[model samples]
Target chain A: MQLQYDIEGGNFTKAGFASSEIKKVLKQLNVDAATIKRIVVSSYEAEVNIVAHAYKGAVTVVIDHEKIVMQYQDEGPGIPDIEQAMVAGYSTASPEVREMGFGAGMGLPNIHKNADDLLIESEVNKGTLVTITIYLKQEGGQ
Target chain B: MQITELAKLTEAQVRCGNGLMHTEILYAAASDLMSDVLTIHHDGMVLLTGLANMQTIRTAEMSDIHCVVLLRNKKATPEMVELAAEHNIILLESPFTMFKACGVLFNAGVQSVY
Candidate 1:
């Protein structure tokens, strides 16, 4: 199954709607609870990032028997330093965003922790694309 | 603790999932940052924070969090209320500040730190 959603920039209120819907679909598919949770977390963080920082973006969710994939593409101020952005405590969000209790700098790190495989590509003046995958099979278990 | 007790303790109004007040919660986490909430390991937890928005409800849904306690007299959108209702998650509003609310709950045997 594949689902796509346009994330509205500067809309803090609607940040996670896409991921919320995808979570519902995953639940209906009877995916393992843990896997569903991980997907929701990673996808939501990515979605929030786009809405908070990007000029605009779209998120794609793809689910298969073996894995779930979420791709986030945004036409926004690209990350000037991917390595710096990936750090757990680094954030470029303004004070306004911090007032809302976000911009704690955990978005990318949390996404990486939840997804089984993660990749990101960006251009400083253009945009960013993030692809994250999570496998159905749990670690160290049959 | 029972959700009903939590509601009474915080002087909260239930906007949805009244039936779920019977649900028990073992731990609580208070944060407006969705990323922080996602980092902590919580199963059957209650989230107490001043942040009331659509994403807040969505975050609770994703984490399997059973209850949301909005502190400092914060308000939630109609859409947020509707979504929480649909998901069967308990929603409560409290006049207490975030610190006071969490402190009250903790004093009443609501375990924190998870």
Candidate 2:
């Protein structure tokens, strides 16, 4: 199954809705509870990043018998240095986002921890695209 | 501890999830940072924090956190209340500060998620 959602920037209220919807779809697919949790966490953090930093964004999620993939693309100030952004304590969030109890800079790290495979692409003046992949099979158990 | 017990121990008002009071909570952690809360996949956990916003509820929903105890009398926005109810996650407002709230719950036999 493939699902897509639009995310509005500067709108914290609507931020996690996409991931929540994805969670429901995953649940219906009978994905295990543990894998569902990882997808939710990984997708949610990526979704919030767009809401916090982008002008707008969209998420594409693909699920099948073997793995689930969530791809988030945003139109906003893209990351200049993905490495710096990956650092745990690094943050460039606005004061407003900080006040809401986010922007501690652990978002990407959390996603990294939860996802079996992650990829990011960005352009400084354009936007960013984040892809997260997690396998459904329990054999290799992450 | 039961969800009601966290409210009782911290002198909190159940702003939502009245039906959830019977749910058992086995672990907890306090933090105002939603990212921190999202770091772990929690089960049977009650999150204690001063942060009350739409993202807090969203964070709990994503992390599988069962309850959120807002410390220092922070107010949960209407959007938060609505979302919490929809997700079946409990929203709580405790009169005690974060330190006191965690301490009180700890003394009452609630295990920390550390």
Candidate number with greatest DockQ: 2
Q: Give the docking tier of candidate 2.
A: high
Which stretches of model 1 miss by more than 4 angstroms? A137-142
Model 2 chain A: ten consecutive residues of lowest lDDT: A133-142
The residue pairs in collision within model 1 are: none
lDDT of 2 by residue, A1-142 (tens): 8899999999987889999999888777777788889999899899989999999999998887789888999999899999999999799999999997889999998899999999999999899999999999543343
lDDT for each residue of candidate 1 in B1-114, tens digit (9 for 90 to 100)? 899988999999998888788999989998887668878667878999888877788878878888999888988778989989988889999899888888888898888764
- Residue A119 CA displacement from its true place in model 1, Å: 0.7
Task: Please give, for residues A1-142, the per-residue lDDT of candidate 1 as tens digits.
Answer: 8899999888887778888889878778777778878888888889888988898999988888788889999999999889999999999998777765678899899989998899999998799999999988544343
Displacement of residue A69 (Cα, Å) in model 1 is 1.5
Model 1, CA-based lDDT: 0.86
The lowest-lDDT stretch of 10 consecutive residues in candidate 1 chain B is: B33-42
Per-prediction DockQ, in order? 0.67, 0.91
